[model samples]
Target: MREDIEFRTEDGVTLRGWHYAPDGATGPTPLVVMAHGFSAVKEHLLDDFAGFFCDGGLGVLVYDNRNLGASDGTPRGEIDPWQQVRDYRTAITWAQTQPWADPERIGIWGSSYSGAHVLVVAALDRRVKAVVSQVPLVSGLANARRLIRSDLFAATRQLFDADRAARYAGAAPQMMQVAWEKDPAEPAALPTQDTHDFFFGPIQDRAPNWRNEVTLRSVEMFVEYEPGAYIADIAPTPLLMVVACQDHLTVADLSLEYFEKARQPKELVALPCGHFEAYVGEAFAESAPRQLAWFRKYL
Candidate 1:
């Protein structure tokens, strides 16, 4: 069972989410609020992940971040870490109102930035019972260094563009097409890969409805937002960190350090691929069952 819907946040911004319940659920069940990664819409990650969890007898709620897809917000892509955390917290509160959900048995699932956000939110809110951090961005400093190593001048240039847009137009202008050049030495900075296509690539070929173009400001925000800093704060609650071994976007070493600092009842599952590959390749198929099993056991 699936239903498209919207819920208002603490600041009056409406968040769009899809509620997917088990097919034959006759009683209340644990809720899984699946948060999408940075600059991504709910339909992208939740479409597949939600189906898996719902099939496993758990209800799922997946939503777009404010100012992104169907959600309401201004100055698109002005992603503040605090604001994103609040949005996820608000979604959890909204989920409690549903009659089919067990209010005290709520879980949060995230990947990339949202995966990191889950740790931050769990630290602040005591209501969350379980968490899944998939390909989590563990450190800002590490990512910043990685970006500079790959394209220092290109990263500086994008920052300049974002600053200019924010000052003159109240929001950074969207990039319909990334500044990617075919030549290697030409300094084109996107995807961080020569052949890595953007989110519009074939992963969504089976489902082409996902549309997202982020304001360049997200580049700056991501560099400053480090959820790894607060990893030790997430205690008692069961945590699962799914690491992408060859990930360039989020370093595996940094994530491992954070996982080590986390309290007991924590588990790390390292996949044999990069950041986006798990969402597209055989890794995702292998990883989904483990995540569902963990959430079912904890929440």
Candidate 2:
């Protein structure tokens, strides 16, 4: 069964979430809090994950981050990693209040950009008993250095500065395409065919609420954010880091570096596929079960 729910953040912003109870559930069950990645909504393949978890006898709470999807906030399309991390904390607090939720067994799950957010959230929020991060963005600076050419870095910085000025001058937030069809003349935040097809192809069709554009300031915040720094802190709490071996977006090597620094009670599973491919097909088939097992053992 599924129910639409709303919760208010400490800042008074009303965030929305979907609560899913396991089929034939008799009483309170462990809840897994989930959210989508960069500029994504709950409908963007998140239901598949939630369904799998719920089917595995775990309750699921999938929500949109502030300023995106069904959530109410200003300056839409803004992607602030820190703010999103805070939203995860708020989601946990809200989940604990649910009548069918086992607060002590609450776990967090995230993919892509949000995968990184869960690491930070688990580190600071001891209440989160377990965490599963798939294809996570560990270091924003490292990823920025890899994705943004050195020649274009300066130009990108200028755009960020310009957007800040424009926003302060009573202008609307500057918007940019999150991903675009491969074109040398038209650069996008994620200007690759894989990113383009994944976001604009069938996924976009399935998720009617997804916006293909994000604020310029979102890119700026993404470049400066670093979630890997908190990985080691997620020690006493169990963590599962799933990596796509052929991932160019988040890159497996950087993720491994942070994973090595992490303490015990952690597990790493490397999938034999690219970042986006891990979302479906044989890769996802291999990953989902492992996640369920980990959550079962820990949460």
Candidate 3:
């Protein structure tokens, strides 16, 4: 069974999500809280993963982050890492109130940027009994340096600074394409076709709420946001970090380094494909079962 649901953050921002309960569930079941990465919406193929969890007898709550999709907040395309993390906490609190959700057995799942989020959430929120982070961003500064050319890095920094100044001066926040074609004349947060197609192609027909743009301030926050520092704290709470071996976007080595720093009771799984491929087809087939088993054991 599935139902549409809404919850408010501590700031009173309304966030929307879908709640999926496994059929024939006799009582309250473990709930897995999920959200998308970057500017993605709940409809961005997240239902696919939610279905997998539901099949494994787990209730699922997949929501849109504040300020995006059906959620309510100012600055439509704003992406704040801390704010989003707080929203996850809010989601967990709301889920615990549900009659069919087991508060003590809740788990969190995310991929890409949000994959990093679950790491921090699991560390800080003891209520989170398990976590599944797939191709997560370990260090924001390292990723920013890797994606942004050294020559253009200064210019990008200037844009972020300028946007901040403009917003303070009563001007609208500057906007930029989150992903775009490779062109020296056009600047995008993710300029490669792989990144662009990864977000736009597969789920285009399904995810009408997904946007290609975000506030320039998001780039500023992206560089300074580091979730890997909290990895070690997630020990005792089982963690599963899935890596895409050929992923150029998140870089497999970066996640591996963080995994090495993490404490025991953690497992690392590597897929033979790139980042986006893991979301669908043969790759997802291999990865989703592992996630299901992990949640079953821990949550």
- For TM-score, candidate 1 versus 3, the one ahead is 3
lDDT of 2 at 216: 88
Q: Residue 210's C-alpha lDDT in candidate 1?
A: 44
> lDDT of each model, Cα atoms only?
0.78, 0.90, 0.91
In angstroms, give how far residue 237 of model 3 lies from its true place.
0.4
In Å, residue 138's CA in model 1 sits off its true spot by 1.2
**Alpha-carbon runs more than 4 Å astray in model 3:** 181-185
lDDT-wise, the better of 1 and 3 is: 3
- Model 2 off-target regions past 4 Å? 181-184
Clashes of each: 0, 0, 0
lDDT tens per residue, model 2, 150-241: 99899999999988899899999999888875563566777666788788777777877777788888899999999999999998999999
- lDDT by residue (tens digit), candidate 1, 1-299: 99997999887899887889899888779999977776667656568889989999999998888877777887665556678999888888888998878999999999988899999988778899999999888786677687566646565656657677676876535443222335444432244661235454665464353444455556656667889877888888889899988877777888887899999889889999888777765988989999999999998
lDDT of 2 at 164: 89
* Model 3 Cα lDDT, one tens digit per residue, 29-99: 99999999988898888899999999899999999998899888989999999999999999999999989
Model 1 TM-score (2 dp):
0.88
Error in Å for residue 86 of model 1 = 0.4
Using Cα atoms with residue i matched to residue i, what is each candidate's TM-score against the true structure? 0.88, 0.97, 0.97
Q: Which of 1 and 2 is ahead in lDDT?
A: 2
By lDDT, highest first, what's the ranking?
3, 2, 1
